[model samples]
Every structure is written in structure tokens, then in C-alpha cells.
Target chain A: MNYNWNWGILFEEPYFDWLVSGVEWTLFVSAVAWIIAFSLGSIVGVARTVDSVPIRAVATAYVELFRNIPLIVQMFLWFYVVPEMVPDDWGRWMKRDMPFPEATSAIFCLGTYTASRVAEQVRAGIESIPVGQRAAGLAMGLTTVQVYRYLLVPVGYRIIVPPLTSEFLTIFKNSSLALTIGVAELLYQARQIENYTFQGFEAFTSVTLIYLVLTMIVVALMVSVEEKTKIPGYGIQKDK
Target chain B: MIMLGDFDFGVIVTALPYLWDGMQLSLLLTGLAAVGSIFLGTLLALMRLSSIRLFQWIGAIWVNFFRSLPLLLVIFWFYFLVPLIVQGQVDAFESALIGFVLFEAAYFCEIMRSGIQSISRGQAWSGYALGLKYSQTMRYVVLPQAFRNMLPILLTQTIILFQDTSLVFVVGLADFMTSAVTVAQRDSRLVELYVFAALVYFVMCYFASLSVKILQKKMHK
Candidate 1:
């Protein structure tokens, strides 16, 4: 413990900017990936529960493929392998296309991988709703899509809220894997700062604290939403 | 598609020695860390459930701090920081093992806590009525049941840990991923080498999951 500790580096202008930008990227990636995960997860989840056998098979395949693969591999594939698969012109286009293409690929990989797990949560939520609701909608001469749109989605979302929150937290953590692809996200920024200053403790401690803050904010938001949409006497009864 | 057909198997053949060497370190790290984490995690779980507020608070914070941070960060912190504090040269593999134990302990704490909590409150009370001290009750009555209930989930977490060992490569440990990357660098076949590494990971994880499923069935009966 005799090593000199530098606390002032955190408040220095350049390092502060790095930290701020890192937080922004982290939040940005999480928010975008969450939207993709929820939307795609709902679609795939509903598909799995559909009456059509073929559709269910396809949905199952999607879930099994993605869920079984590690998130790091998926990120590497998206960032490295899939891009190589593109036609030469298109590959070049993507390579030169944007400034933050690595970030975009990371978002795509993280979001899609998480969506598979979210799909299971969605399917479970929808299935938990009594079949009678769908039956009532059908008996009213509603189309299958209409039944889902009007009846299934609302109730299913409420039921899936807690698990979805967990998935969101996961996506936030998985975003750190983007560091492997050289994206200057929070973790990457921390590494950069560490290498530059050789102040490993300060840099990592700052990164850890940032992640804790972000996750806590996400938990708080999810709790508020859960409270707002809660159905009385349902899942996860509140402790007095 | 760049065909994998043109690849030379000699790379893998030559790489086997290195892979075997790395596997020893990987398995050793996993085994040691698994044992350490389980013991520490169980202690933390008991502390969290204890009647004393201080114990509960300390346990909660321990779990939160380690669980929320990325495993890589945890590993890097220990790998870099421990030497500074202890003023001794720690090797890469030992540092990685220490990191894995600390990081995995947090997760194991959460898993064991839930497992213990799943048991009805009456079970503990029944132990108390039988004239068991708190520690005796936990050891004789509570833990056996909780461990049984948690065996499957615990196995699943082990599978996760197995894959997580790959992250140790970041700290320059010559584990599976590092060995693969080393071969890839020498042969200039990064994609195929990484794919092979992925296959190795998949097989290990898949078997772990299968064994857990079988164990779950036997335990239920």
C-alpha cells in the first residue's frame, strides 16, 4: 500500500472528458440495445407461442442459437466475421461508412444476443396470461394479430417487466465487451486512461463506480415503472 | 466464404502441446477458485441471513460490489493492485485465480442466498425447537437441504465460470483462449483458430449443462 496514489487525475480536464464520454457511450449503447431487445424479443416470443408449428420451430431455433453462444463470440463475429462476409463493395462501404461503426456493431451484437434471453421471458409472460383472454378475444371475432395487439401485449409486458429489467442490466454489463473491439466505451476508456497514466487503481475504481451508478439508475427506473404498472395481488408481492 | 478446407491441421497438431500446458493452468485455476468461492460465498450467504445488522450489511455490500463490476475489471484490479499492496511478485496465473475467486464469490453468494431463502422459514424454526444451536441448525438442518435444492443452478454457474476462464487471457495467462490466439498469430489464421477455440468452449459448456440436467432428475427422485 506504499505506492503513491493519485486522486487528482480523476478531476483533470482530459480524464474528466474521457469519463463523461465513456458514461455517455455506455448509456447510449444500453438504451439502444434495450429497445432492440424488447421489440425483437416480443416478436420472437409471440412467434414461439403461435399456433403454427413452423413458426414456433423457427423461433425456437433463433433462441437456442443465440442463447447458447457466448456474448463475446457474438460480438467478435459481428465486429469481425460478419463484416468480412459482406460483398467487397459493401464491406468497404461499411468500413468507411461511419465514425463509430465499431460501436454500432457492438450494439447490434449485444442487443441481439440479449434478445434471445428476453424472448424466453416474453414467452413465459405471455403464456402466464390465462388462455381465456385470448379465447375471449377470438370469440369476439378479433383477428389473431388484433388479439395480440389488444390483449396479449399489454398484460404480457407487465408480467415480463421484472425479467426484462434484469435483461437490461445484462445488456449494460455486456456493453463492456465492446472494449475488445476497441470502442472507447466506459471500460475501454478506463483502460486507455490506465495505460496513459499507469494509475490502475484510480482508473479501475472510477470505472467500477461508474458502472455501479449506471446500474443503480437503471434499477431505480425499472422499479418506478414496475410500481406504476403493477397489478394488485399479482407477481412479486411487495414487502410491507 | 473463405473455406476452412485449405487450413492446415498441423497448426493444431503443433499447438496441442501449448494447449495442454495452458489447460493445466486453466483447470487448476478453475478448481481452486471454485472451491474457494463456494466456501466464501456460503459464509457470506449465512452472514446475509444472520440476525445481526452489521453482518447483513457487510454481506450485501460485498455481493453488490463484486457482482456489479465486470469480471475483467475484477481480474485486472487484483492482477495490478495486489502486487502494489503486498509488495511481492505474484505470477499471472495465481493473480488470475485470486481474481476469479473474488469475482465468482459474489455470484455464488447471490445464488446460495436465494437457495437458502427458498426453504420455508419453518424449517429453521423446527431445527430450533429440536434444541439445535443456530450454527448447528444451519449446518445440520438448513444447508443440506439448500445445497441439494441449489445443486443444478450451482452447476449451471460452474459452466458460466468455465467460459469465464477465457477472460483470464486478458491478463496474459496462457489459458485456452490465449493458447489459441498464440497459434493463430503464428499461423495467420485468426478466424479458424478463434472458431476452434469457440468449439472447445461450446463442448465444455454443453457437457456441463447436460450433467446438471441429469443431476437435477436424480435429485428430484
Candidate 2:
């Protein structure tokens, strides 16, 4: 290899700032989208599991539509098409009022798309609980909502934690697609740095390392959580 | 002041040649990558499941590194880095294809590993009891069952890879999306052009998914 590998570019002040800002945006997007996806997923997941036919139908439709569409396409649709379709005042409000406008749109798009997958996981989690638990709640004179609130949701969340963590990591990786719409996240920053210095290898390699670190951190955290929640002697409660 | 209706669809009509050219590139990339990934992935899966500690570590690291990074970054690394190091002009499409194969192999390995693990340990033991070597057992018994179980998932991953082929456009390869973008830029019809391109992608992916479902049903029987 005749070419010198300049590790110093990563240490340079401006590049360091770009790297940190990129990591921050990456975390911010992942955290915000995870929260959004979790909330939306729980709601839709509950809906899907509920006995009400209409609720199930709506939830199923939502999951099918979002899951089938590509995340990039969804991001574009949210950033471009939805705004165009909205009435002028509302559209302007959305464009102007959203925090970190471009990043927010990406988060919203990624979050909702991921929520569909999370929703399915949650539904499976909820359904996996023995029917006897719900029956016992009903026998104890609790309403359906009360049974879910007091029993099912908590147990389901605990059981589904592992899969939910996998979903979060996925949403985190998918956030990189936001670069297409000009979000100055890690991948986007790398692209900017590359454009400026024409150091594509250096820029991409650094970002790849950062992503690897982030994902490893997520996996470690999830594993610890899984260990913490493991019920002794009840070998790995399987949630489909 | 370009009105949507006033714009000629003839641009799209005329760009059919370019679109066909791009489609051929897309298909070639997808096919080559799919085949490469499946081969590499199967080997990685076996390595991961091997009794040897060193092989397991190597396989684990390979899967971890590839799966964690975004596909675009991988493509960029190969496109820019490999040439600088190797002192050869690798074509943009080849770099993109190699990148996709490498990245996707990790995912396919994981899927295959899971499928293999799902099978009972007795399957392998029985082969041993029948005097088969490990390699022979894997080839004749374990892999046959594991591959069947993995067929649907592999097909699903293929659909994913097909969509991911669009990412190659970022590296300046004129795949379908890139061609659309080029034509659209010339005519300043970003929205329409992107919309049409997305429809093409959606149609391709939709059919891929549908066929997978059909195959899954047929395989199940």
C-alpha cells in the first residue's frame, strides 16, 4: 500500500466536531424514534390484540401498509408528498413548527415504519400470555381494559423486551437513510466531509466504526436487560 | 413555472432506452450479489456453528461488522478504498455489487444460523450414528433440512437486497433510480420522476414479495 493512511484527519478539530455532532444526531434520532415507535407500537399492538374487529382491522391495515413500503420511500413521502397534499396553512405549520425540521421528518417516517414491526412483536407478546391469566382477571371481576392494564401489558413488555431491543437497533440503523433528505446526521456528516476533502475512504470508515460501536452498545444493553428480566428456572419464555 | 400537466410524458417515453439499460445493470448487480451472498453466507453460517473457537470468532466478527454499518457506507468504502489500496480501477457497479454481497452475507448467515439451530440436534447425531462424517452429514442431511426451512426467509432477504440495489446510485452507478434522477434533473421534474421511479421499485418489490409467499406455500406442501 503506497498511499499513506491519515489517521490525523479524524483528530483534527473541525472533523472531530463533525464526528461528535453526527453521533449526537444519530443518538437523538434513534432515541426519539425509539420512543415514538414504542408508544405507537404499543397502541397498535394492543389494538391488534383486542377482540374488537374494527380495531384489529385498522391495526392490521396500518402494519401491512407501513411494513410493505420501503423506509426511504416513506421518508420521501413524508418530507415531500404529505406536505404537498396538506392544506397550505397546516402544511406551513408542520414545516415551520417541527423541531430540527429535516431530522424530525426522518424520525417521524422511520419511527412510524418501525412501529409497524414493533406492533407485530407486541401483538405476539400480548397474545403469547396464557388465556388463563386474562380469564382469571375476568373471574376476579375486572373489565377487559382493566385486565390488560393490570396484567397483560406489563407481562408482555417484560417478555418482549429482547425483540423490542432488536427493533430499536433496526430503527437506529434505518435512521441513516435520513441523509438523503439532507439531515446532518452521522452518515450525512461523513458525506459532507467526503465532499469537502474527497477522503471518501477515511470518512466512511470512521462512520462505519461509529455505527459498529453504537450497535454493540445497544446489543450489550439489551443483553443486560434480558439477563435482568430472565425468570430463574423458567428457561427463556418464548414469545413468537 | 413548470406545470405538471404541461410537462411532456414523452421524456419518460424517450428515456425508455436509458431505463432499460439501467434495469439491466440493476438485474445484473442483484443477481451477482444474491449468488455471492448466498455462497459466502452459507460458509459463514457453518463457521459460526463450528466447534472451533477461532472460526466462530472470525464468523461472529464478520457478521457483526457488516450488519451494523449502513449499506451506503460499505459501498463507499469499497468504491473508494479498495482501488486506492489495490491500485486498480474497480468499476463503480462492481464495487457496489461486492459491497452488497458482503453486507447481505452477514444477514443471510444470521438467518441461516437461526434456521439451522431450529432443527433438533438429533438430526446431526443420527447422521453420525449412520457413520457419516460431519461434512457429509451437513451436506446430505442437516443442510437439506436447514435450507428448506430457510427458503422463505432467503427469498424475503432477496427482496430486501433488490430494494437495496437502489443505494448503489449514490456511488454514481446508473441504476434505475439514478437514471430517473438524471432524466428528471435534465427536465426539472423532480417530483414526477421520483414518483415514477418509486412506483417501479414498489412494483418490483411487490412482485418479489408475492412470489416469495407463493413459493412458501408450495414449499410447505
lDDT of 1 at A98: 53
Candidate 2 docking classification: acceptable
Question: Which of the numbered candidates is closest to the native, going by highest TM-score?
Answer: 1
Candidate 2 wrong stretches, greater than 4 Å: A93-99, A231-240, B1-21, B129-131, B214-221
Q: After superposition, how far is residue B210 of candidate 1 from its true place, in Å?
A: 3.6
lDDT of 1 by residue, B121-202 (tens): 9999999999999999999988989988998988788777877787777677888777877787788866666666666666
Please give the lDDT score at residue B133 for candidate 1: 97
Report lDDT (CA) for all predictions.
0.82, 0.83
- How many residue pairs clash per model? 0, 0
What TM-score would candidate 2 get against the native? 0.89
User: What DockQ, on C-alphas, does every prediction get?
Assistant: 0.43, 0.38
Tens-digit lDDT string for candidate 1 (A46-108): 999999999999998888678655666676677766655666676677678855889889889
